[model samples]
Target: MDKTQNPNNNEMVIDLVDLAKALWRRAWAIVLVMVIFGGAAFGYARFLVTPLYQASAMMYVNNSSINVGSTQVDLNDLTAAQSLVETYIVILKTRGTLEQVIEEENLPYDYETLSGMIEAGAVNSTEVFEIQVTSADPEEAERIANCVAEILPDRIAEIVEGSSVKIVDYAIVPSQKSSPSISRYTLLGLLLGAVVSCGIIVLLYLFDDQIRDEEYVRQTFDLPLLAAIPDLTGKNSGSSYYYSKKTSGKEATP
Candidate 1:
């Protein structure tokens, strides 16, 4: 092979055919490891993590004039009201509001943890907003959602003057727990683990210098193989002249 114009260049290219061959050679090991790891992950996810119930409530910016005496609500004023509502949604999950929720609910968790559990966001391109609360206790999740829904407007009003946001829908007692998504996560883990296992196997196989196949021998050295010598074992003494004499105790086999 030339230094630049190599004769073996065509054989060194990587493609699907080469990948398929490598994976086929190592399929059993990949499948076994994927199954073991996938099962372990599924088991741990299903059994180890505590289940949490999520409760959500819908609220919207009322945008109605605080002064009933006013004749009309300005469009610009409504836009500003929506923006303010978004700000209040961010404020809803703050330590102050969360601390109040903790005190009102008598939750076992502290303020910091309770703050972490509350999630709030506005529905895009609309006045509607949602508040989600997660808890190990389903009723408590609902209670927290409803509590925030009921109390948040007043809290906002106290913080910002002339606000008119209201709850359109209250949180209902949730029927489903949200954690331990075993089916989806387990399948994902299996796919990732299998790919990684096969990748490592193929890489190691390619880097290894052991002569495992006729292709390896032919590629490493251009030569013609004519014959292979047989082992001079005593078991073949009847068919071989050298081992026959050793078996007859006349001489030792080479």
Candidate 2:
């Protein structure tokens, strides 16, 4: 059996070099569009988005009080205390503790809302842990964090017998906002700008149909070369050039 048939691709050929050239020629326009989008995004994020502030209190778990005559906690005791960090967190999040915080602070938030604002996590998986409160008002965040710090140990002792923790650092009013980072927002805006600008350029390149020179005809139609025409002006710049009726006036002979 003869196997001389070559498979035909039948795919339309795209000139990436031409597309690249077209994009390069309109680089300034693309950059302008990108800047406009990026600036708008930055402005929206900076001015419109609500910023959140975080205040945290650092705590150290101390189980030594339960170990009579022990001056310092052992490694095993510390490991066991680390295990109780979650129990302490649970006690801190109880409806009773949260309701008390709201009552003492006279917060407008209810149990559920107040609970949602507080977060607890272990630091480096050791006995140390942090209680963070996030709120729109920085002072409120600090107050809530401190309130939790002051109340957590008592709550833990009530729930877990002979378990206690000490405050390493009290919550302080944060000077800066935790959320709505301007740099991150600006970066996202720039990425959006690049995508939008590049998309428009690609679309314009794909939709353009104007042909330039004999090369276009030969490649597009698979046609053989014919007799060439000579340019008298010797300034042929192809379809990319526009033949304008507006002409540069000749300088008067001095």
The best candidate in terms of lDDT: 2
Q: Tell me model 2's lDDT, rounded to 2 decimals.
A: 0.78
Best by TM-score: 2
Candidate 1's C-alpha runs over 4 A off are 1-19, 65-75, 212-215, 221-254
lDDT (0 to 1) per candidate: 0.72, 0.78
lDDT by residue (127-178, candidate 1, tens digit) is 7788999888899999999998888888887777766578889999989889
Q: What is the C-alpha RMSD of each candidate to the true structure, in Å?
A: 8.7, 10.2
User: Clash pairs of candidate 1?
Assistant: none
Model 1 error, position 140 (Å): 1.1
